[model samples]
Target: MSYPNPNPYGPPPGQQPGYGYPQQQPPSPYGAYPGGGMMPGAPAPYPTVMPGGVKAARVMLFVLAGLNLIGLIFAVMGLGSVSKASKNASEYTTSDAMTAMNVGKGLLIAVIVVIVLFIGAAIMLGAQFGNGGSGVRVGTIIFGVANTLVSLLSFPFGLVHTVLGILIIVFVSKDDGTAWFNRPRY
Candidate 1:
């Protein structure tokens, strides 16, 4: 038969919960204590951190720029075609082409203006990637909304731009994007 321990109320001898023995600590109320552990609602401490999905936003801007470039090219080609046709019609037919020519000129100016505005906005949006302030984010969102609405005016021709603009708005407004913009810096 084995003998009973002298102190029954506590752990026996070296088996006590201290020194070399392991002991379970109570759950911390404040969460992670130190090191690289992340606390809930705490921003990441890494310097290379960026907003989520910013790449896609930048890509959208680049796509918009490409579309604007395409529009410029198309506008140039259409202008050339219209100019040649109008000149030929005026030379071949006695009917007055002045009104038609004036209308075509007006359309050309309008197309050029729209294309320039979009191209400029696209470049600005792309340039601000990873380096812009809160103002840039707000401005981009506004630009995207305005672009989408105006693009809708172009209907079938602008459907792609409208979709891209919508995507930009969504991506920029995401939690990661906001965190990146609002993250503290040195």
Candidate 2:
């Protein structure tokens, strides 16, 4: 049986609201909206994880550069000490002076070569963080792996550097880091 309408202002009995009645909320764990309550109409989220590794990679490069400098200072000091000792010993032997001087010069040259190679590498890696392309990522990975292996030869002297280099390698290869390198820059 159909029921007659009692009031004229409100909607008829058993009929849907045409204009004034508020909408009913759906059942959910979180009152109305779920998934952290995002608004009904909002723009898609932007990429955020891509820019984080950049600063970390740059800082690691700077740290490695400082280590290279410290190594250079130590190498120079040791070279000086060896040369001084050799000079004192050579005074006792008549023909040993020239030979000793030659050895000292050779040792100094070797140290200088190693220092130049490593310091140059450090500078290159450090400078790349500014506006580096994808090649920089590959370069950094190569450097980090090579550095870790080379550092092992130095043992205690390069322990810290090895650890830091490994971290650099890991960071550069991660998802976010890869994304950062692959990003399109206009």
The C-alpha local distance difference test score for the whole of candidate 1 amounts to 0.78
Off by over 4 Å in 1: 1-47, 91-97
Candidate 2 residue-wise lDDT, 1-186, digit = tens: 876777877887777777567666654433345456545555324334445666686687778878888877877887888777666774466666667767877877696777678678767876866566688889889888887887898889889888988988988888667766766666
Using all chains and alpha carbons, the TM-scores for the candidates as numbered come to 0.70, 0.63
Error of 1 at 123 (Å): 1.5
On lDDT, the candidate that comes out on top is 1
Name the TM-score of candidate 2: 0.63
Q: Enumerate residue pairs that collide in model 2.
A: none
Best by TM-score: 1
The sequence of per-residue lDDT tens digits that candidate 1 reaches over residues 39-64 is: 67764543365655778888889889
Clash counts for all predictions? 0, 0
